[model samples]
Target: MQVDVAILIIIYAYVTTLVVLWFLMKVRPKFPSGISIGIVVFLGIATTMAVVTILEFAIAPVGRPASRVISIARGLKIAAIEETMKLIVAALGILIAKNEAKWVDTKLSLAFVSGFTFGITEALFYVARNSYSLFGLVNLFLSRLIHPVFTVSLVGGILLFRYGKRIEGVLVASYSYLGHALLDHYLTACACYISSAVILLALASFAGAVYLLMPKIEAERKQRGEFEKEATVELKDHWLNKM
Candidate 1:
């Protein structure tokens, strides 16, 4: 079958850009002012895409002829690298928020935004290459979903950080990387039906996990707000009593 690799690549590029942007708008209301957010988004996307591309090139040679098996291994390696980079970004976001005494939502949202921006830039670059056929395009589409799925894992890592267990955060980040790699390797190397089915299942699982996590994150944000307010009130009263 002459795989319409181009179509698949386009689909992936479109879907990933849409999902990441949608998530950013939905999760982060106070996303800077005007020019700053746009600039940050553009830079984030460019930087991440460059990093991913370099990583892919570096790892591709290890696979030699790029047979199905080797391609699968390469895909996994790329996934691991992408996820790891996203995780590091997420961790840095969390650490910054903690130091600044910012809300947890802000930290989580920033981390996801960085990831989404990264995905969008990568998608555009891949589509621009015009390298794939129908089958290749389909492969690209399926592969693109991994970005958001792995990004959700980064969110989970941020939550672990909120709970004051940085180790748990690291573990969550590593899990995201492994999950991404496993998914990519299997889908790229297996039979078409098997690969498509597994990708669908993974998407469903990712959606469900995100749904479950949202309420918990909201609750935590509210609780933190209350605690902050109470502490502020106590400080005010202490100052008044001293006066």
Candidate 2:
């Protein structure tokens, strides 16, 4: 019986990896396989966790909150902090890669990979505490997938800024931050007060949202690359003509 269960778990892991890889291919055709991109993801995760640790220490301590409203407010602050962290790390990673003069594929791949690292790291930490049983896997995966995808959804803002769309980038980044905060607020608040079933649905919703939006991001990323290349060429030609 134990052997049978073990075999089943192995099979499940294999299937899960294949499915995840398939979806990843859809969202990013050549992602989860790039070494440098994986490095950026690792760095992004490290940066986010380290910075958040400092932020928490710097912030004032609050006693057990007086009301649900206060608790909710604190949760919202957490969301803001985390969402901001993702943006900052992701943008920083992109800039660093750009400064290195990596191609558009590397730059574009880093954004999503970094965002995914953040989410998967979060999932891993939670799973460590809970330890997985069959019942826990779905909740575990969904919960882990949501936030990174949230950040992935907003990678457009950072990409735009990289392409000289400063105003648009800031606007989109702000919107992304607010949306992340709201989603986190809702999920955290409900999880505290509601059933696991609702939490499951919320997780699924967030993941679905990311899956649906990825193609559009692919379009935007492609279009922005073309625009930036054109501008760069124009600048180069102008300088050469002047010389």
Scored by TM-score, the top model is 1
Tens digits of lDDT, candidate 2, 51-111: 5555442111112233332244565576677776776665666665554424343443555
Off by over 4 Å in 2: 1-35, 48-72, 99-106, 160-172, 191-243
Cα lDDT for residue 226, candidate 1: 96
Q: Give the TM-score of candidate 1.
A: 0.58
Q: Please provide, for model 1 over 1-243, each residue's C-alpha lDDT reduced to its tens digit, 9 standing for 90 to 100.
A: 324333333333454455545555545423333443454466567668778678643211112333644354566677666766665665555454454325555555555566666765665677676566676555455455456556765666556656665775666655565555654554344333444444444444444444445676577668878989999999999999999
Please give the range of 10 consecutive residues that has the lowest summed lDDT in model 2.
57-66
Best by lDDT: 1
Mind sharing the TM-score for model 2?
0.52
Worst 10 residues of 1 by lDDT: 57-66
lDDT of each: 0.55, 0.51
Clashes of each: 12, 0
Residue 193 Cα positional deviation in candidate 2, in Å, after optimal superposition: 13
